[model samples]
Target: MRIKLTYESLDGDIILPKHYNYHIQALIYKTFTPDLATKLHNVGFPLGKRRFKLFTFSRILEKGIPTKDNEKLIFKRKITIYFSSPIEDIVGNLAERSFKEREFKLCNKKIYISQLEIVTTPKIENKVIIKALSPITIYSTLYKKDGEKIVHYYKPIDKEFSKLIEKNAKKKYHLLYGKDAEQMSLEIKPLKFSVQENLKIIKFKDTIIEGYTGIYELLGDPELIYLTYETGLGNKNSAGFGMWEIWRGKESDEDA
Candidate 1:
């Protein structure tokens, strides 16, 4: 349910906003059937609740590091996308419409689909460790001094972190599946992490949230784990947050 994509600048140069992750996600949805695309795009549909969405993605990468050449910034050759929904429509939709040499708009700039590769990650086990392929953003209500309410555009590890992740992960599971998700014995503990700060789209506006790219220990139902894998671990997943990959090992091991 994941794909590695390589796009080349159709015009030999392309420019994107520094916070361009959401744009790439949109292009992917537009490649699907019109109705599905509309469904995916209408984030507020279904009674103003996103109850029928699935999938996540990794960061759009550039070769080594991005280099600025005057007004244009050069990017890497490849980026990746992941889909967790087992719905045939999404898979079939993309397969039918993914035409080679197709053009896409990222941050209103043009790029051609150069290469596409499907990748498979390990299935959820009774207990497994997961690492973030992209940063994760959660929506939580926290109170500050004088009872000020804080919207978690980005939340640090707090008493509510574990509870929020579990709550949201289960809620997404129910959204994808009609029945209530079978909450297994689970502990969402952040073992290792590095702060990932960035801009995210909320109500079509730029917002700063404290997101993190890191690893967590999961002990729960296999289905729950798989659902998290497909849809992402936190909110705004459909908008490019909370995608995960299996931890290979220490960076020095160069595990492949």
Candidate 2:
């Protein structure tokens, strides 16, 4: 894990431990989004590149002979921002400096407010994937609690219901795990079955209510099941929303 330290203002200056490496500093900056990205770019900081050096390590044996082979130690470049005040203040001052075409005063020196560092590892981008599963007709009932306020209840079609009702009942199912397949095949199951339920409601001082409730169910083979769920809620502050999620199963004991 990477750690970041930001001070509001400098009553006194601060120093970093000599042992800390540049790569660690870079990792800290990577945790934030556009703020750091834009700043680094504006300062002409190099991107998608890194620098490092190699050192050799050796082990000595009891017989005074070198036993273990020499190993290489590598270092890379990273960037760290040091400020006399809190992070918020540092960001503000940096912005002000940028707008005024002036440099920020730090550590008793005028600096550009950004630093370049060397790290041991390369940076990676984050990826997200979204998939759709089978759809089912939702049987819902609405009740009014007050003016312009309503609650909805949904349940699965009874097994003994008419064929038409059964055919229309929403087909609920879980997502199954697969490896790199472009298309997925889903097996629908009963929507009423769920392994867990989570519910929360928040009421603001202005009497605006907002909440969320969700249910999860597992499907597929025991060794590679998919989990699925539906969630939604709303109040005076905003209209409620509902969504579904499905994902592959955790590794089995055999894999562990």
Candidate 3:
């Protein structure tokens, strides 16, 4: 399920950390019941050695602009966010709390949910166009010559990018349905891409992550494609990465 959440500040301006993904994630956890929150935080659904939180959210969207320095983002009035998950329980918890508790603390600023709506799910097919609402990220953990840990982020065009995404999707499928998705096939083709321009650098607390945003063509099994839509593509999805929406071929195509 996917939902659109719009928040309006009670105060004049809404202030947030420039890198606010961690705050957004914290807010999401706060919405859940304590038991649910603890479960998701301490122990999510397990598949082998890895755990899947199974939820993803889009970047905060706001029309008003304010000053931006090195540490904070201040916006006037309203902001919109998109949240999605294939698990009905997870979506239910978020929607229920968000609606019941109209007011929320985004960082230290206070805001209220002005509107909450369930976004209609688009039909998935073997071939579809998508645009990232949040940057997509995939990476490999490695050790340096000195035995220090490092992360190597992959570009969209890198062979590992699509391969890892497909592999990750299957793992999600297994966790969701308790069935192996080895038969599912998926491929990602970049339709609009530029490394210098599309690359996004984000900070989650002290850790830095790199991701990309662009239009892409997805060719795959319909089920797996939908899974990517709900659970997000690539890694660090729960940290507000890899949320996407189907792209209409033209502006007027919405009614078609």
lDDT per model vs. reference: 0.63, 0.24, 0.87
Residues 149-247 of candidate 2 have per-residue lDDT tens digits of 454423222332222222221111111122422232223334333222222322223332222222223232321111112111011101112222332
lDDT at 58, model 2? 9
The candidates, ranked best first by lDDT, are: 3, 1, 2
Kindly state the number of residue pairs that clash in model 2: 19
TM-score rank order: 3, 1, 2
- RMSD (Cα, Å) of candidate 1? 4.2
1 or 2, which is superior by lDDT? 1
Instruction: Tell me the spans in candidate 2 whose CA falls farther than 4 Å from its real position.
Output: 1-197, 204-244, 250-256
> Best candidate, lDDT-wise?
3
Best by TM-score: 3
What overall lDDT, based on C-alpha atoms, would model 2 receive against the true structure? 0.24
Better of 2 and 3 by lDDT: 3
Indicate the TM-score of model 1.
Answer: 0.78
TM-score result, candidate 3: 0.94
